[model samples]
Structures are given as C-alpha cells and as structure tokens.
Target: MKPLDPRLLRRARGARVFLAASVLIGVASGVLIVVQAVLLAHGITGVVLRGSGVSGVALGLALVVAGRALLVWAQEVVAQRAAAAVKSTLRRQVLEHSLKLGPVWLSGERSSALTTLLTKGLDDLDPYFARYLPQLVLASTVPAGVIGWMATGDLIAAGTVLVTLPLIPIFMALIGWATQARSRRRQHALAVLAHHFADVVGGLTTLKLFGRAKAQESAVRRVTDQHRAASMGSLRLAFLSSFALELLASISVALVAVGVGLRLVDGKLGLETALMVLILAPEAYLPLRQVGLQFHASADGVAASEEVFRVLETPLPMRGDRTDVPDLRVSPLQLYDVTVRYTGRDEPALDGFDLELRPGEVVALTGPSGAGKSTALAVLLGFVEPERGVVVAGGSAADEFDPIEWRRQFAWVPQRPGLRLGSIADNVRLGRPTASDDEVRLALLTAGAGELALDKPVGEQGQLLSGGQQRRVALARALLTNAPVLLLDEPTAGLDPDAEAAVISGLRATGRTVLMVAHRPALIAAADRTVSVGARELVNA
Candidate 1:
C-alpha cells in the first residue's frame, strides 16, 4: 500500500473526512510553530540584546504553545476515530464479499488465516492511523512552512535545508523498502502460526487417539519460535532505522546552526533573526524524522491493508437483480447440460449434467466419491456457477432470480453441518427462528431425533453429539424450514440401519421436493429414483 492508499478514502468514508481534517490541522500546526519560534526569538533578543521586560512576549508565547498542544490533541482524537471507522468498514466489506464469493471459494481458503486477519491482523493498524498518518500530514505541511519562513529571514539557512531535506526521505525510502519486506514476512509468520494452531486444536482428539498429541509439541514450538524471530527481526530493523533517521536529522540541524552562528559572529545577521532561523531549522527536520520513525510502526498495518484490499476487490459472481422467482412447487428446477470446472483441475467436476427436479419427489444422486454429486447440489444451491449451460426454473433461467432469494427456496444440509455453541433447540431454531417449542419437537421427531433432549447442549461444531446424532439434528433443522426443496448431502452417511431407516421415514413424511447425494444402498433404495452422476450419459436406476 502507498503512504495514503486512495482505496481507503474511496471505500471508507471516515478516511476522507480524516484527511481533510488532517490537512487543516497540519496547516494550523505549521503556522503556530513558526509563530512560536518568532515569539521565543523576539523575547530572548529583547531580554539579552537590550534592556527589555519579559511581559510583552510572555502572553503571546503561552497562547501559541497552548494552541499547538490543542492541535496535537485534536489530531490524536481524529486519528483514533478514523482508525476505528476504517477498520470496521473494511471488516464489514470483507465479510460481505466473502459471502458473495460463496462456499466454493471459501472451501479453498484457510479459515484460521482469515480469522487472524480480521481480528489481530487489522488491529495492527492502530499505530498507522493514530500516529504515522497524522505525522505524514505534518511532514508535508510543517517542513515546507518552516523553510519558507526561514527564507524570508536567512536565505542561507533555508537553502541548506532545501539541499539536505531530500536526504532524509531518500534514506527513508531505502530503509522502508527493507522494512516492508520484513513486515510482510512477520505478518505471514503470524498467519502461519494461527493456521497451525487451529489445525492442531481441531485435530487434537485424533492426535490423542493415535498417541501423537505429545509429538506435536515440537512442531508447535517450532512455529512459535519462527513467529518470535520474525517479530524480533522487524523490531530490530525498526530501531536501526529510527537511529539512522535521528542521526541524519541531527547532522542537518547542526549544519544550519553552525552557518547561522558564524554569520551572527561576523555581525552580518541580527541576533533575533539568527535565533529564529536556528530554531526553525530543527523544526523543519522534526516532522521528516518523525515520519521516518513512524513508518516502521505502521509497516505491518500497511501490509495487512493490502491483504484486506485484495479480498475486497475480488469480483463477486454475476448474479441476477430479479427477485421474482418461480414457485418451486409448480415450476420444475432443471439443470440442462450444466458443466462446472474448478480451478487447477483438468477435468470438469460436473460435465453435461442434466437433471430435472419436479415437485414432491425424492431424487437420489448416486455415483463414485469424486463424481461431482456434491457439486451438483452446490449448483442447485447457487453456490457455484456452471461454466456452461443454465439452470431453468419456470421457463426463467436460474441466474434470472436473485441468488439470495433463489437460495431461500431450498433448505440445504451439507455433509458437515455447522452448529454453534448452543442447545439442540437453539440450533434447530436457526432454520426457523420463530418456531414454537412444539414445532421444534415435531421437527426433531420427524428427523428421528425425538429421543435427543431439546435442552441438550451441543458444543462448538456440534462436538457434544455423535456423528449420527449431529446429522439428525441437522436434518431436524432442515425439516423446520418452510422452504419447498430439501437438499441433503449424505444425510445418513454414518448412521446405523435403524437410524438410516428413521431418516428415510422422515423424508417420506416431508412433502417437499428432495434432492440427496446418496452413497449407501439404503438411501438409494429409499429414493423414488436414482440417477448415476459420473458419466456423460445419465443412467437411471
């Protein structure tokens, strides 16, 4: 990202306001700085060079100082608010765009990395907004104003500043190039550590079962150490860059002071003018030095913002603006010669796939594991756009209906249902939040989960329930929906014969149109008809 990425101002409203305010503050600060220096030089020259009282300059000096302090405080307040609003806006955009990209895109991404980016990663931007950016505005305004003021009094001092001012930024650019690389590496390390830790925790149970949990200690330690090293490396470089900037600025200020003092000694310049020039020289270099120092602090945030922008800029799949979807109960859902080819795969996931889902019929999609059974369901759910062909409903193309509205017509249960930390009733209520307790019980009973307690707590990802029980809960949730179509992805994959039979019974009881990805013989037998999905030629069983 550049010093001030225009994307931020375009995407976040707060940034535009912040920039305008910063400019005003920067200009005011510059004027106050020059005024303060002039007042101090006048007071000193009056008291030292001549018999004069302190009363004249005292009040004006105090007011100038107070005004400068107020500007600093105001800048701080504005920067903090801008940081918060920008982060909030970016986070919301990322989430909304992720949804538009759909599950297929997300399935290929690392959820842990994304979680870290949204949480810890973006938080690193606090320094960028609060300190670095405000200083950047000052750097642009204060130095120019200071030099221009000095020029009116002493051209030599102003010329020296003009000659050396570029050095600080030149050095900054060189060091910043290196710092940016390190910051990016540190950010990557943090993401990798987060991803690794989430994976370990997610698979901790299996690791313990295999007596390999203890063995993972070394791996975790290694990743943690890498993150630590990267962090320390970034900090060390930041310190070195700060030291270098300070050294360069100090040298530049000293040069101006030496020239001013020599000219004053020769009686070639007045004491008051010499003192004012001397004071303003350091002031000119101060903002530039601060910019160089704060750049290091904000590097991580700049790197993270790049990642956020990448996600925000991703093109959403083309969806229809129309909301008038055909009634599923009357109009058949048809996928005619639909072909879906995922990235990096030579063969299409589903090629020349044709299926028609009529009203109130349970159709089973059965084929080998890699045969795109789930992909077919994904297409129906509007999660994946077919590379070729279109899904037609009531003589209107599926793309003609708004994606969200089209999805609302179907109740979908993935192979692994995502259940949050809640009771069984709470999870089921997600399908229909306004459902009464009796309706919940009826749905659970129909899905063969009547034996399970409604108040039973399901841990994160439904860990508290067994695989079969989780599937039943998911099915019950689906059963509670008012959607006309129920799309189940192997709803009874791990169930015993009795449990499978109960699920089949539940399907028969629900009069909704059904499409299921089935592998087991029992589920296929239960379906009204089975269609094999792998081959180009559709085989009905």
Candidate 2:
C-alpha cells in the first residue's frame, strides 16, 4: 500500500500554529548561523587582536554564541511539537477511517501492518520533524541568506558555492528515488516479519500440540532472516549514497579553504573578508549536506508513512450524513437483495439474500462455514458495505444514514474477546467511558461475570480468564452499552453448560432487536427466530 503523503500533513487543520512556529524557528536558526559566522570572522579573526580592543569582540562573540544556542534549542522544541501534532492528527484520521472501512478493507490487509503504521511508523517521523524539517527550512533560508551576504563580500566565492550547491540535491534526488523503492520493499518485509513472528509466538502452544513446532520455528526464522537481509540491503545503499554526498561536500569546502588562503596571502582580501569566506562557504554547504543526510534518514519514515497517508486518503466504504440518524428501537430492519462479496472474490458469500428483522425480534443466521452469517452482521454494523444492495434499519436506508449515529444504537460484542492489559472494570468501561463503578459492577453481574471485578487484572487479551469468562466479560460490556441493537457471532461456542445457559437468559432478557450468528444448540434453541442460509440464499423463519 502507498504510505500517507507528507503533502497531506501540510493541509492538516490544527497544524497552523505548529507549522508557523516551525517556520519561525527555521528563520531564527538561519539568522543565528549568519550572526555567529560574522562574529567569528570579524570579532576574533579580524578586529579582535589586530588593532581593536577586547571589549567589542568579546561582547559580540558572547551574544552571538548565546543567540545561536538559544535558536538551536527553540528550533528543537518547535520541531517536537510539530512532530507530535502531525502524529496525533494523522493517527486519529487513520482510526476514524478504519471504522468506516471495516472488515471490507481489513479482511485482506494484515493487522500487523496496520499496527506498525500506528506505532513504529509514526514514531519514525520524530527525527524527520525534529532534525530534517528544521534543516529543510534552513536549507532554503540559510543558503539564500549566505548567497545574499556573499554578493556583498565576494561574488566569486558565492558563485562557486552556489554552483556546487545544486550538485548536492541532484545527487540526493537520484539516491532518494532509488532509496524510495528500496525503502518501500524494506518496510513491507518488516511488516511481514512482524506478522509472522506475532502469529508464531501466539500459536506456539498449538503448534507444539500438533507436533509442528519445529516447522513453525523454521518458517519464522526464514521470514526474519529474509527481513534482515532486505533491511541490510537498503541500509547499504543509503550509506553509500550518504558517503558519496559527504565526500562531495568535503571537496567543496576544501576548495573554498584553499582559495581563501591564497587570496589572503596575496593581500587581495582582508583578514575579516577571508575569514568570512572561509566560514560562510562551509556554513552554506553544511545546510545542503544536512538536507541530503536528513533526506537519507527520512527515507524509511517516508516509505512507512506513505502507506498511512494512502489509508487517510481512501474514501470510507460507507459514508454517512454529518448529522445524527434516528434510532430504530421501535421499527423493523430490512435487507434488500444484499450480496456480501469479498473484494477480488469471483463469487459472493451471500448472494441476493433478502431478509427483514423487526423490533423486539431476535434472529439467528445459521449455515456451514463461510455461509456469510458474520458477513451479514459486519454489513449491518456499518463495517462493510454490500456489493449489490441496501440495509434498511427501521424504515431508513443505511447508506444515507449517519453511520456513527446509527452505530451508537448498538452494543456489539464480536466472537473473540479483545481485552487489553487492564483491570476487570477497565474492560467494561471501553464500551462506555463514563460508566461508574457501580454501573460497571451491575453490567458484569448482568452478564454473570461480576465476580471478576476489583479482584484481578485481566491479563493480555484476558488470557487470565477462561474462554467462557472472556466471553462473559465482553457480554458485560455490550450490556453496559444498553444500545437498541445487539449483534454477536458464535459468542458461547466454547462455554460450558452453566455459562451457556446464563448467556442465553441474558440474550432473552435484552428486550431489543438482536441478530446473532449461532452454532450452539442452546443459543439456537433460545433464539426467537432461526434463519438458515444455504448454498447462496437465506431460508426465512
């Protein structure tokens, strides 16, 4: 996938202040560099020991150095703020966009890749923001400032430096183009490696049980080894390119040093003028070199972030009205000729399946694997859109409705329980951030999991809880939400008899519209209506 573009960041709404501050820092950094150079050339090299007293030069150098230090500090501080702002703005957009795209887009993409984009990929932008960005600004401002000053002191020196300046960017652009391709591949490899390793580690116990642990280990090793080789290949190219650019910069600066020395010996130039040429030439080239090096450093970030930008640019699969949509607590939901098809699949999962669900009704969709039970719910949740039809909720077409408002009426619990590393109370609060202690406890009790509250931490992904307990905790969150609609898929698949009975009772007492994909006999037996899906159609209740 193409990473998010940096150009989009330039258009971020809340970025004006940070952008302006970064610009100001760049200006200040440029001014300070010039002032410090002039102070060194005139204050110490020319007027200090030659004839003039220590008072003027001493005071000037001190002020100039102080200003330079402060400017550097200010530039760094502004860059950090800008980087953070950029990260948060982009990240929020990604998350919001993902909600709209849902499983339609995500089913084909790797979760590890998405996770990398939000975490490690975003973190990589910090250096670009803090170091390279200020330099990008200084690269423009400092060079022009030096050139203008050069026109006043020595046009020949200015002309020479300007002549070599274009060469740096040209070489940099060439390397950058090549590096861009490599960076993209390298990033892809890293994502693949991360996905493979995460899967292998999580399934190690299962692999051992199946007597395939050695094979799995070998597979992961091959993936990681390939990733390492790809990374080193990219690193080698970037290093060679940087080395070539640095050698060129060194040559340019050395030429200036020689010219200034000869000109001074011939007395064609004064001590201060020669010193200024010596200082300004390198300072001017330094920014250019800095730009080139910074570009090198930002290559990986550019490659990684380009994909993020693309995600932000992708139009959401389901678009909603900017305003709120009415709740359908009292009306029926209708699906008209809806065919749920995975993108790139020749055959649709649910072909022209038509159904209607009324208020206070609990419908269960049952069929063999891949019969589109879960896909149907995914479409209703506004996570995926149908390829051929519409989902009407309570007399309103879902396409034209506000997705966020419509989803606000739901208390969704997916088949798997995804709990973070937190307490039992923390798990339920995700459904409703404002839930009080008593409210959370009540919701847990309602789901038959109140005993878990205030006693232990729900380990990573709630590994501490049995499968049944995990499902109940997730159910508690759904209950706490108290939405008008409830959608679940294979919720009690692994639960014992007692736990399954508790869940079935809770489902019956929900007293609202419900749609679930069930395989459990208890759940199906308890459902108000059961709809069986066949080869390519749904058999109505």
The best candidate by TM-score is: 1
Off by over 4 Å in 2: 1-8, 11-19, 28-55, 103-107, 211-217, 254-272, 322-327, 421-457, 496-502, 520-522, 525-528, 534-541
lDDT accuracy of residue 261 in candidate 1: 93
- Report how far residue 515 has shifted in candidate 1, in Å: 1.0
Model 1 score (lDDT): 0.92
Q: What is the TM-score of each candidate against the true structure?
A: 0.97, 0.85
Every candidate's CA RMSD: 1.4, 3.8
Model 1 segments beyond 4 Å from truth? none
Per-model C-alpha lDDT, please?
0.92, 0.78
What digit string (tens of lDDT, one per residue) describes model 2 on residues 1-541? Answer: 1222446456464346655676676677667777767777877664555766667767887887888788788888877887788888888888887867866577677888899888988788787777776777778788888877866787777888888888998887788778888878888888988898888888887899999989986798898898898889887997798799899999988877787788789988778877877888888888878877777577777776688878877777656684446566877788888887776789888888777888888888888988888878878887777889998875568878777777887777787768888888888888898999999888887777766755578898888888888888888888889898888888787888887887777777768788888987788877778887654444444
Candidate 1: residue pairs that collide:
none
> Lowest summed lDDT over 10 consecutive residues: which window, candidate 1?
532-541
Could you tell me which 10 consecutive residues in candidate 2 have the lowest summed lDDT? 1-10
